[model samples]
Target: MPTAAHAHAHALDLGRFVMASPSSFHAAAEGARRLAGEGFEVLSEIDAWPGGPGKYAVVRDGALIAWTVPEGAGATTPFRILGAHTDSPSFKLKPKPTTGRLGWLQAGVEVYGGPLLNSWLDRDLRLAGRLVTLDGAQHLAATGPLLRFPQLAIHLDRAVNEGLALGKQQHMNPVWGLGDPSAEDLLGVLAEAAGVDPYEVGGFDVVVADTQEPAVFGAHGEFFASGRLDNLSSVHAGLVALVQAAEATDAEGAPIAVLAAFDHEEVGSASRSGASGPFLEDVLARIGDGLGASAGDRRRAFAASWHVSADAGHAVHPNYPERHDPANHPLLGGGPLLKINANQRYATDAAGAALWATVCGEAEVPYQEFVSNNDVPCGSTIGPLTATRLGIRTVDVGIPLLSMHSARELAGVQDPWRLSRAVERFFAQAG
Candidate 1:
């Protein structure tokens, strides 16, 4: 059960998470720090597993998996998995990124995912991601507003309102300042931002992001606005649920709870730390091995596991109502959404959808159904990929929001609280 004050505090915490996590690497580090604060042991892939009743977490690049094993839990015990991605659509910096013309310096960038490129124009942008040093270790760095993409004025383009054209290679470069550009310029700036020497900075994997802080707004604070809400919001919700479930006991026979946050979701999730890779599958196998499970026991445990894909869902846009399915449109403040697609894009089946409804109803959590218009193709998430990879029962679910894939997105103020509650309940309940 959650109180009003608890909900408010959780919203505030979510805001902090959004502000702190400007990149996927930072998001994973923040998640790991939070889990560690709750006394969850950090396990390394190279080391042997400590088999026993305990709370443990493993990190691979930006992806993470944390689980809680209850006292007297067995090898064949079922698992309750809460899944979310840490990465969002943004402009990733490329190697040899210096570019300049007409006394202006710009940084070369590549689109990481399908983002509304127009929204990024003229916005206050910064750089954040991992900086790998000469020694082969990595360090994270976030610089304040250091870049901007100025838009052409109506005076320059008389038909600007008619239809603005943005070329990925030609128009998306963000200008930082007026100076001579060099190969060492961006790295030097990054090193200075991180308070380290430029010589020590060997390479980097950074991205340009919005520098604006997330806030709760609207009349009487009925809405919230933030960048990277497409997935980090779900990450925060799942993190809260995992931490809370670790502190509470389940029913007489409940499954172990696990939270898996993966990176590279924006770029098709094909990397070593991505959903298409072996990160989650390997982590689950290692968890089973740590529990002293045999091959058959591990298979049985996987058969009994369930995964909830927590990503942000689309709320019917007020200005673009025609784009939504008339009968199945979701709205802000509508609580969690059971996202479904007939084309298998979402991985939500009839049984999984019903299970979501049952959990929401039992927790007194408001929920709605979302099916894309027949003509509008649905987007993909880690749900389908995880289900296929691990052969687990997976359901797609999330909070309703507008302006998805934009530089900044919006959601109802109450939705985050409702989502966190529903996810906590999902971990609390069992088959």
Candidate 2:
């Protein structure tokens, strides 16, 4: 169990991380920056890798993979991986982004994932992502409180207090300013923020983000509210654990610890940098080759490996108790969640559950089991995909949250710190 002061400190750091990571690309870059600051060398895919007994990190688009190799690591040394995603549900900017009618300057956007549409209404928004130049240079851009999606006044729609209906095409466009679309170029705004010429930008991958800063509120200061907490919470936990594991002095026989933060998970994870893609495989293969691992040796190493897939799970909503499993009512501050799904939506099995229990027990942390109601459809995570792709044993685990896909999400302040401590124990534990 973490003390209140320690938990509050961790939550403040998480808030800083969330504020720095407005987009997936920014998340990966921020992760790499932090890893580099901790003496981890940044490796480029185009360059040759110097593997063995060192800490290294690499970024592929919006995804990041980092690992720490011990002094006694060999070709058959097993790996302990923590997997998380970097993306959240939001709207993405479409091509010919500048669009408006009359006096309203609106930007063209496409719904990227399954976000709570009603929650995006009447919130301040900003555009953030990477801008690619014609010469293949990438520049990061972020606008601060530049757009808004205002709701219709109740006086106009007299059926107030009724269900709100938001059309994806007709009602989702956000207004940025009052100007003519032809006269104003939205790309110019991003280009200026990135300190690059607008004409140099050949393409872009931008998304909208909530501009509100993360807050720690609620009775007794027990609650934490922030945007993009769905997966960033997991990513931050893995990062903190990995950094601490790298600094440990007694990691003589421990397995290689890895942190895999992927992108595009909210959209089914089919992109080049997603878990379903070859980015992770490519990095692992290269690392194996550097260790002189043959096919048999690589298989032996993988056979002993373990992957912990961390994502956000639902805490029983106070008003929607019937939607959750009656026997399993996970609370916000109860600890982290060990997610289980009968239909293989999550990859946790008996063996994985046992392993998770052992890890948590060693760390002296409590955890809750999460299962969906039989009538309710359960959501999936990257656990099954990673297990299917690499044949490595995987367990699905996460911290409980209240509003899952809302523009802003909620969590218990202590749970995030507790999750990090458990992950650090997992990383240091021998196979």
RMSD of each: 1.6, 1.1
Give per-residue CA lDDT, model 1, range 1-431, as digits (tens): 44556666777899899888888888988889889999999888899987877888888888888988877678898889988999999999898778888889999999989999999998999999888889988888899999999998999999999999999999998999887785338777887877778789788889888988888777776788899988988899988888888876444676788999999988999999999999888877877887788999988998988899999999998899889998987888778789999989999999899889888887788898999998888898999999998899999999898989899899887788888888888897765
List candidate 1 stretches off by more than 4 Å: 1-4, 249-251
- Candidate 1 to truth, TM: 0.97
What's the alpha carbon RMSD for model 1? 1.6
- Model 2 Cα lDDT, one tens digit per residue, 1-431: 34889889999999999999999999999999999999999999999999778999999999999999887888998888999999999999998999999899999999988999989999999999999999999999999999988899999998857878899999999999997898999999999999999999999999999999999999899999999998999999999999999987246788889999999999999989999999888887888888899999999999999999999999999899999999999999899999999899999999999999999999888999999999999999999999999999999999999989899999999899989988998888776
Best by TM-score: 2
Task: TM-score each candidate.
Answer: 0.97, 0.99
Error of 1 at 264 (Å): 1.0
